[model samples]
Every structure is written in C-alpha cells, then in structure tokens.
Target: MITEARQPPGGGIGIAVRDLKVAYGGTRVLHGVSLDFAPGSFTALLGSSGCGKTTLLRALSGFVPVESGSILLGGEDIARLPPEKRGMAMVFQSYALWPHMSVHQNIGYGLKLRGASRAEIDAKVTSVLSILGLAGYESRKVTALSGGQRQRVALGRALAVDPPVLLLDEPLSNLDAKIRLAMRHELKSLHRRLGLTAIHVTHDQEEAMTMADEIVILDAGRVLQKGSPEEVYRAPNSPFVAAFLGADNVIAGEARLDGEALAIRLPNGGETRMPAARRVEGDCIIHFRANAVHFGAGSTRAGLRLAGRITQSSYPGGVYRYEVETPAGRFLVDDERRANPGEAIELLIPTEEMHVFPAGMPSA
Candidate 1:
C-alpha cells in the first residue's frame, strides 16, 4: 500500500477539449472533437481503430499538431504548449522504456533531464518503485523484465514526474490476459490513491468499462456518446453505438403505435409489444445481447418470441453458446442448457433488454 508521504502532489486538475481538430496530411483524423475530464476523474477514449481515439489522446499530449481549437488544462489553454510543458505524462502502447536503462534510471529519467541532483533522483525513484511494488528491482535492466514488469516500469516513469494528469495509450495491451486483468485493478487503485486526472485510450470495451469513470465513444472521427459505462451500455442512442457495444443480435421489423406501447411486426408474422420511449412508428431495428435471451417462451414477459433452429453449438467456458437460425437472421444465444445442433428452440427476449432504433441507421 502507498502511504501519504509517497503520494504525488498537485493532482486533481480538470481538462476540457473544445472544437479540437487534427489531420494527417489531407485526412482529418479528429473532426471537431470536444469533451471534458473532471478533476481527478478517469476518462477512457474508446473506439475501433481509425476512430481517432489515439489521435485525440496524442493531441491532448501535444504529440500531434492540432489543426484547430483548444485543449484546456485547469482552465488554461495548453493546445499550443509542447508536450513537456503541458504538465502531463504519457504511457505509450509500446512501453517506450530505454533498453539499456535500469528500472531506477528509467523511472528517474524525467527528473534527471530536469537537472535534479543524484540524491533527489534516488529518493524519488525509490518512492516510485515502492509505490509500483518494485522496490527491490531498482538495479534490474528493463530489457530483462517480464511484460507485466515492463508495463509497471513504463507507468512508474510517468508517475515519477508527478504530473497533475496522466495519459495512457493502451498500456496493458501487450500483457497476457491474466496479467492484464491484475494490472487493471492496480492501475485503477493507483489512480484513486494519487488523485491524478487520467485519460486512457483503448479499443477494448471491457477494459474501458472496467477502469474508466466515464466513457467517450468515438466513431469515424466523431463523438457518438459520452456517459458512464452503464449508461452507454444500457441506453445506446444509435444502431452503430449499440452494435459496437456488443448488442450483436439484430432483427429487422416494423414498429407501430399500439396504445402507449410500440408494437413490432416481424416478417415471420410474429408481433410483440414493448413500452415505447421514442415514438418510432415505421421500419426499425431491434438489438439485444446473446446473454439476454432465454431458451423458452414460457415466461409471462412482454418481449419478442422467435422460433429458431440451432445451427451450431459450442462451449466457451461457463455457458453454452448456440448459433440459432431464424427467418429474419442468424443469432447467437448463450445459455447454460446443452442443446444439440438441428434442435428447435424458442428465444425469449425480455422487453427491457431490447434496444429499438429506427431502420436505415448505421449498423457497422
């Protein structure tokens, strides 16, 4: 556990990005992106590759030149400042540690560059090593460390500077799955303990959901949604957002107003009514996760009922996953019960788990 004496100072600074734009040659990577990071909050920039998530992070760190707009740190525009002068530290996706440097040297390189004395560097490195659970490995060369250790060294280097904000660019992407899970807890704990504002860029949805206080999802260089993990997952505003967030079972239907409820008529002559939030009275798309489906129609809930034939079955661990073929489309369903291929099954999807969006929306 890190003590108060070892905690980095001058944290809890807020950041605001306004109309930020960046381009690579003729292609604009960030299309007028704007967002905010509350003081001491951890925000994750999440999107598929080419969505400009990394570009946004790099722009904030001053690694990429901004084409237009401002990046405000603590209410001061730092968009024009150089990376070092921006008062932020970044942990790269490659770890970016010097191969010849020892752990202590790697962690203290920033301080040494700033003309700190040998004694001062030693003390700071020692404290940072302890905080990173690497106190005894100070003299070990970075090249000799394991992937997880190397990650810690990279993080330690950033933390040693004690900047008010930290930028992480998928720092755990290279670690093995088990180590990655463990590091997630460590990083979250460290962020809370240090109270530093953090902006993390990641393509992994689970990582963003688990580690971030807020999730900013971007698509095609545009902001799609910004909310807590649950908010975005539960109430996606568009078909693209819903599909990207793992609502993979999509069905096409036509919706009509049925009293205060919305009735969806499927091509297979099946109809279901769900409480309507938005008055979508036309062709629409409905999406739900595999786990949201049950293997029976006995439930007395108001939801979609689909008759499907199991085309494939596999066990990926705790549950059985089945690919069900229906008249509309093939859908993936997860359940604990074992059902063989070619077996007919009834899919029951609760109304609360269904996400309805108008047709012709982007599903990619």
Candidate 2:
C-alpha cells in the first residue's frame, strides 16, 4: 500500500565542488577536482580503475576528508559536514545489507536511526517496498533474496530517507548482464520519476553512455573532460579520451598543411588527406573505431585508403573482425564479408571519422 510517489527535497538540489583535493596518508587520490551537478540531472563519473572516481564520490559524501576546497550544495558549503548531514544517500557496490535483517527492518534502518517513530517507519517502508516492487517481501530476510532483490532493498533504503541527492558507487557492477541492463533502465526511470540529482561512478563506458546525461572523464585523479555523452564520444579533446572511449585503432604518420586539408604520409608509403581546422604540422597520431573502417576500394567517398593483408580473422557474432596489417600499423576492422588470413585487401576510412592528435600526447 503505497500512497503517493515520494519526491526528493526541493525536487532535487544542485551541487558544486571547487578545487577539491583528497589524499590517503601520504598518497594523493584526488587532485583539485572541480565539477558541477545540475539539479535533477544524472552525471556519470567515468574512468579506469585507480582513477580516483570513487574517491571523488566519497569526498562529496563526506566519507573521505577533503584536504582543500569546498563542496557547496544549495548555495551552502557542506564540506565539513558529516555523511548524514550532507543531505545525500549512497548505494554501495556491495549492496551493504544486513543478512540477518528482514527487508522491512533493512529498509527502515535509516528512519530508525533518525529517531522516527515505529508507525512512521512502517508507513515509509511500506511505501518504499511498493515503489520498488517488493511489497510482499518485507518479512523475507536479505539472505533469502536474489542479488537483484537485494539491490532493490539497498535502493529502497536510500530512497526511504528522501535525500536530495543520490550517489551510486558501481551498484550495478555485480549483477548478471541481463539484470544489470534491466537495472540501468530501472534506475534511469526512477531518477526521472522522482527528479533526484544523481552522481554515478562507473568504469563501464557503455553503461555511462547509456544512462548518464553528462559524462565526466577522469585520469590520474584529475578531470580530463566533461560533456554530454554524445559530445564527449563524438569529439574527444585528447588522444587519451579518444582511446578510452572506444576509438582504439591508432595510426602514426607525419602531416603537413596543404590548402584546407592536411596531407599525411604513412610509414608504408601510403598517403591520405583530411580537413584541417587546427594548425597541425609534423608528427601526429590518428584514432578511429574498428567499425568506422570500410572494406574494399569501392567507396566513392573522400577518405584515407590503405593496401594491406589480413593477418587474422575471428567471428565475434554478427560481423567478422579482421586484423589488417597496413603499412602504417596493424589495425582492427569489423566487416560482414568474410576474408581469410594472408588475403590482400584495401581499407577505406572516412575523413570525418578520423581523430588526429599531435604525437607524444598522453595515450592513457
């Protein structure tokens, strides 16, 4: 028996972090990271492991001490506040539920901690379980629930308190693929329905791209790029960002400006020209996705063409993936037409799909 959908405070409150820094003993994990979380917006902090994404989230939640800078929420600085006072609730990756506790007690634990009356706790727990589609399982112990159900209980616990902000630390990482996908949609729908400000930290690129309104790329404890998912994926600012976002095919070549395009000379005596919008001269590296490459020289589009031989081939489901040994380098290309190894072939890569950055740039 659910009454009405619960709304977060003020329909979600914005958060601002300014030059935040955090360290573990003598080692620094976050280096002056600054970000803004728009009210009712979902942002995903994306990075590789040990990139400090979790550290940043914990700092904002007051679980980690900030060495410098401030965390502002609703125009008030809450950097010094404890976790409970920050007006946020966190759902951990481990589904931090008590195995011995029933779903009802687990969901109402936060309310009880805040000194809420028994009747009030019961009402809130009932509403949460119903909203989470667990109405009849309140008396079931967490040990008897499936992973997905346990996760729902964890989310229920967080939502029961009605915090203005919701923080997720890879909460979907442990579930099976099917359940994880379903949970992604569920979380997104829930966030929209409740208009809650959410900050999710995950290393999965596809998960971030599909769920987040904004994606923040982090590396070595620093913010590398922040933009809409399409913006960052389509126009990465650096080679590291490009490679990290799935544009893994890389080529090294020399470039020189030629009118409106830059003529590139590959190591294997091949040549290509791409539009020049920036002052790029000398050694450079090019990046594109495996799917961006087209087989054969039949394409009439203007692009880079290279003659190569297929060194390896594999069937990774619907398409055949080939490793092409070009004069520039060994490149991965995905195509429907099957080809045997040692067979000569040509590759056509559209100019628009090429991401060129100066050589010696960071690849991580």
Candidate 3:
C-alpha cells in the first residue's frame, strides 16, 4: 500500500486510487487501474459487463480486498480502512431496500446504525424524504411503491449519511426506458444541486454521456480512455473505444504514412488522403458513425468515399437505417430521407470526423 504525502499546511478531502490491481484466485481481473475524483465532481466509469467496473467499485467500498494497490481518501491511505470508516455511500442497481420496512424506516436505517437520537433520526428522515419527493408515502411499505419510487428511496437512504463521495453501480439498469431517462435527468440535477462527488458505474454509453462530466471508458479490466463525453465521442484514442462507445461503421484499409497525412488504399484499389493515423501499418480500420455520413452525393470529392449499394432498410423512428455494401466492407448508415432497397447510394465521408486505428483490436 502506498503512503500518501501529508498536507503541507492546508487541507482538503478528495479520493484517489493509485496503481490499483485486483485478482480472483489466479486470473487477474484488473491491472493497475488508477483514477482521481475531485471533491465535488461527478464522473462515470463506463464499460461492458465483466470489465471489472463493479469489482473496482466494491474494492473502493471496502467490500473486496485489493491484491495490490492503495485507495487514498481524505488525503490518507484507506485501503486498510473498513467500509463504515470510509465515509462513503453506495446505491446498488437492485434497489436493495428491505421489503418489510416502511419508506421512513428504510431511509433512517443508516442513521440508526450510527447511533443517532430518536428525534434526530426522525428529523433527518423527514428532511430526506422531502428532499427526495417522497414525503406523503413515508408510512407506506417499500413493496407498495413503483420502481422509480423505490429507486428514489434507495437514493434517499444513501444521501441520509451525507457521505463525501457517492458510488452508484448501474442504478438505472432495471427501470423501463422512459423511467430510466427520467431518472438520469433527476440524478444529474440532484448531483449538481447537492454538489456531491460521485462515481457511477454503467455499461450504457448514452447514460454515461448524458449524465457524467467526465467519462472513463474501460475494457477487459483496464481503463482505455478518460475524458469529457465530447472528447471521447469525437476524438477516440483507440479502436476498442470507438466501437464500444456506439455503433461505428469500421473499414479495413491499407495506410501509408505521408508528411502529416495518410494515404489510404481501399480494398477496391481506390486511394484517399486523410490525417496521419497513430500507427503506420499495412492494414487498419477506420470507423465512422452512421449519422456522420451523408447519403447519395456521388463519391465524396474532398475526403474518402467508396461505391456502395443499399441492401436493406429499417425504420426505427424518425430516420431510416440502411445497410450499404461498400468496397472496403459493409456499413450501416442513417438516412433521414427514406429509400427502397437495392437503390444505389453514395456515403459522403467527411475528412474531419473519421477515426483510424490499428486492426485486430479486441471487442468488449
């Protein structure tokens, strides 16, 4: 465990993890994952299932032991501290409320364990319920409430302790689509109003992008990228991040290094000039989102373009999705104007909004 430096005359409480590693038996799950959270900032740790996000959160909460590393809380090393001593609260995905208890009792359970007076607990519970918009249903059993209500009750319980940091483990996964979106807005507003430092774990990219100030993208137990939602979305550093963050149409091509640009040789022997990729290689893949390309404008004159025929079409809502067969490979494109199948279309590729990376990158 690392012994952090003492305050040199001033003080503040923030959380930092250094060279964190965790393993299950023989196989390692996390490898040297490190992150820093400001005292009043909200960040989200996002990755697919089994990517070790939950494992890392559990380790921070003191529910799991770290194989090798240190967790620094309040400017002191706390890998050895017990859960209660860490002064943190967690809201799980399953709404883990006691079914037999009333909403009031559920919200007051943490204070009771901390040994607060009867009147103190009552006041705190009433205040919290009012804050959570659950005042009228305090006497009602937890089982009688809706899913969103239960979720709010769970949140109220976590907030009653007034921990400096909040850790949420996929707290919106179980709700319906509309409720989930509403909860996202509520959580965002509540976090801003309360000024709570929070780290939320989620696999949903949209949830992370919409709710978090900074997004930490993880894969296979390692943090792949950490930045604002716009940064990660517009300028992805790796192929894995680009693909995992959303549906990206990736193409395999041959890249040759130019002065500050790259000449890409398409599979059909066509060539296009693009910005210099990270690695100069014989083969690589470039990904663009479906909405990034414009349809039916002939070969893109300024940037790269491939000849493709619209093979299939599907309407999800406002826009139509088209599967186009291109020379490099197939690609999914979104067209606002609908068209029948077997129509010829040109995918206009913009030079600025394209991503190029090494091939054979692993998937989530």
TM-scores, in order shown? 0.95, 0.94, 0.91
Q: Choose 1 or 2, whichever is better by TM-score.
A: 1
So what's the TM-score on candidate 1? 0.95
Residue-level lDDT tens digits of model 3 in 1-364:
1112121211124789998998888788989999988877789999989999999899899888788889999788888788888877899899899998999899889999999998998888877777677776779999999988899899989988777788999999999899899889888877776677889999999999999999998888898999999999988888788878763777778888888888887787656787775656778787777677757474434666667888999999988988888776777788788778898877766766678776776643
Candidate 3, residue 133: how far the Cα is off, in Å: 1.2
Clashes of 1: 0
Candidate 2 yields a Cα-based lDDT of 0.89
Model 2 stretches with alpha carbons more than 4 Å out: 1-10, 258-260
Q: How large an RMSD does model 3 have?
A: 6.1
Per-residue lDDT, model 1, residue 330, is 83
lDDT of each: 0.89, 0.89, 0.82
Candidate 1 achieves a global lDDT of 0.89
Top TM-score model? 1
Candidate 3 displacement at residue 15 in angstroms: 1.3
